[model samples]
Target chain A: AQTVTQSQPEMSVQEAETVTLSCTYDTSESDYYLFWYKQPPSRQMILVIRQEAYKQQNATENRFSVNFQKAAKSFSLKISDSQLGDAAMHFCAYSFNFGNEKLTFGTGTRLTIIP
Target chain B: SQTIHQWPATLVQPVGSPLSLECTVEGTSNPNLYWYRQAAGRGLQLLFYSVGIGQISSEVPQNLSASRPQDRQFILSSKKLLLSDSGFYLCAWTGGPGETQYFGPGTRLLVL
Candidate 1:
């Protein structure tokens, strides 16, 4: 079974600053995918960024990026130039490269954007 | 683009009562659907997933059940609701492998 861990229960970042949310996972498979999802007050899950274990270049989407350390089983999300709207509950999720499509998600980290 | 929808944004039921929740997806066909439950201040717990119509897979042993009657419609049901079942239920769908999943607005279920 794969398990994702987000140690930081809560994180605060000032507007226009940068913040990183740490996440680690336990997986035996070498080929897998890591995803970061954002859930706003509306309770809607939004994809922030994704990293493929086979790719060492990492993944970047606009202001969102991920530092994927496959060997370390660590995938952290970094948000730059954070805005007030960035406040939300962030979750780290994992999926296998093969037939299994189910996503295993971490508890989550509540991000507070201080304006 | 694809859009997923879950009906009855909020539901309240008594213990031992029956449960039924519907989820639908539009602008796509033959999508893979999933049902997830999230407890208070917790992450998502995948309850069921269907790759095609009439195909349902359960992730955990629980009192709930799921059914997929149509290609884009999925339903979650329970014979008797329990207080522990109270939580936010989410519906998601993916086009295929390695694709981003689109989530619905989620239904909040409360069992008394």
Candidate 2:
């Protein structure tokens, strides 16, 4: 069984500033995927960024990036030049490379953009 | 581009009533489909996933059940609704196992 943990329940960042959301997971599998999903007011789960365990380099998508420490079992999301639209509930999810397609997700961190 | 659709953007059902939610994917074939429930202020909980037609894998034991009648159609159902079942239901699909998943606009279900 795998479990994901998001220690922060809520976070706030000023517009145009940067913010980092922490996430950690427990998994015995060596091959896996880590993902960050954002759910805005519309309730649409949008993919923010993804990092493969095999890839030592962190994944970056425009204003979003991740600090993936495989040995530490930590994958954190970093949002640069944050905007009001970035205000949403962010979730960290984990999935094995094979077998079932089910994803285990963390409790989530509610991000608020402070004007 | 591939897309996913979930119906009844919002639903309200009385306790003990039967419930059904439909999800469909377009522009793809034999894609992996999944059903997730997001409770208030919480993250997603994987309820069920299907790799192919008639191949449903349940992740949690609950009042709900899922079926994949067709390659692109997935349905979530329950014989009777429970207050605990009230939450936002999201339908997602991946190109295949281990691939990134794309999600559809979730359906908000309120069991009163």
Candidate 3:
């Protein structure tokens, strides 16, 4: 079974600073996908960023980017220029590259933006 | 662009009562759909997924069951509810396997 882990249970960063949330996974499959999802107090699960295992280049969306280390089995999310709106619960998830696979999610990291 | 939606934003039901949650997708056809449950302070758990209108695959064995009667519609139902079943239920969809799954706003279910 594939598993995703977010070592940091909670994290805080000052406004305008950069925060990197750590994530690692255990998978025997050679091809897969990693994702970071954000859930605010409203309980909406919003997709933050996604990284494909086959892609050597990492994924970046606006202020959100990932440092994907496939050999190390690590996928960390970096939030740059953090704003108040960035405060939320972040979840790391995994899915297989083929078949109708389900996403296996980590426990989540609660992010607090100290302004 | 495609969008996913789940109904009954919030619900409170007594034990042994039935449950019915609906999810629909717009601007997409024959997309893969999924049902997930997030227990308080826990990660999201995949309950079921469907690749087509009538094909449903369950990830975990539980009191819940899912059905896809239409190409863009999925339903989660339970014959009887339990207190342990209380949680925030989320519906998601993707174009296919390995694709980024988009989530709905989620429905909060509280069984007392």
- Cα RMSD, each candidate: 0.8, 1.0, 0.9
Sorted on TM-score, highest at the top, how do the candidates line up? Answer: 1, 3, 2
Highest-DockQ candidate: 3
lDDT of model 3, residue B69: 94
Give the per-residue lDDT digits (tens) of candidate 3, residues A1-112: 8999999999999999999999999999989989999999999999999988999999999999999999999999999999999999999999997777579999999999
Which consecutive 10 residues in model 3 chain A have the weakest lDDT in total? A94-103
Off by over 4 Å in 2: none
Docking class of 3: high
Kindly state the number of residue pairs that clash in model 2: 0
Per-residue lDDT tens digits for candidate 1, residues B1-112, read 7789998999999999999999999999999899999999999999999999999999999999999999999999999999999999999998888877779999999999
Residues A1-115, model 1: lDDT tens digits: 8999999999999999999999999999988888999999999999888888889898999999999988899999999999999999999999997664789999999999999
The per-model lDDT (C-alpha) reads: 0.94, 0.94, 0.94
lDDT of 2 by residue, B1-112 (tens): 9999999899999999998899999999999999999998888989999999999999899999999999999999999999999999999999976789999998999999
The stretch of ten residues in a row with the least summed lDDT in candidate 2 chain A is A95-104
Q: What is the lDDT of residue A65 in candidate 3?
A: 96
Give the alpha carbon lDDT tens digit for every residue of B1-112 in model 3: 8988899999999999999999999998889899999999989999999999889999999999999999999999999999999999999999876778999999999999
Query: In candidate 1, which residue ranges exceed 4 Å CA deviation?
Result: none
Evaluation by DockQ, superior candidate among 1 and 2: 2
